[model samples]
Target: MDSDSHPAAAPADDKTWEELVKNVLRAEMMRRGVSYAALAERLAAFGITDNELNLRNKVSRGRFTAVFLMQVLKALEVEWVHVPASIDDAARKGGAQALAASKRQP
Candidate 1:
């Protein structure tokens, strides 16, 4: 997807790295006007089945593997942001805070 077409980058908050990444994917989908079904169809071209694609899109921790993430990025036509390399110290701290918050949630 064209960088110009993407939504304005939001400031990273107290959200886990995974949550932040998932939010980015959701935001990109909205910006592209692509439905989950359409994304699944595109992933099918990469041999990712509907059920598997659906699970991946759900953003459950264990459900999202590295390969799955790569496929999702490819299907979404979004620039792949490498987590470890791209996340700054502030982002990492925010993610840690988010993780702590989730653990405290009842």
Candidate 2:
């Protein structure tokens, strides 16, 4: 049984999680038809002051902090987040790679 014969599954890296969160948040925003301007207003209601450009940059970069995520979710009135049964499925369906591919299209 050579170790090289069967490679083990690689752990989920930070980028994967970041992209997943980014996709989820953006999707939710899209679903609710909430623009960055609108979202900024909603967040302000929670005492989370952030401009539209900053929010867009933060979300597009997918590097926001957990506290920021909580604030956004709360502002969006998100009761629950849907999790895929497997991370692989999520990556395929709503991961950074998928997001990038979609952006490249016309």
Candidate number of the best TM-score: 2
Total clashes for model 2: 0
Quantify all predictions' global Cα lDDT against the true fold.
Answer: 0.57, 0.74
Output the worst ten-in-a-row residue range by lDDT, candidate 2: 97-106
Per-residue C-alpha lDDT of model 1 across residues 10-102, encoded as one tens digit per residue = 556535555556654555565567777788888888998876455554753423667877787788887744333234431443453333233
Candidate 1 residue-wise lDDT at 71: 80
Q: Which candidate tops lDDT?
A: 2
Q: Kindly provide the TM-score of model 1 when superposed on the true structure, using C-alpha atoms.
A: 0.52
Residues 1-106 of candidate 2 have per-residue lDDT tens digits of 7766854454469876666678778867865778899999999998889999999999987898899999998999878776533445445445634433342211
Candidate 1 overall lDDT versus native: 0.57
TM-score of each: 0.52, 0.71
**Model 2 local distance difference test score:** 0.74
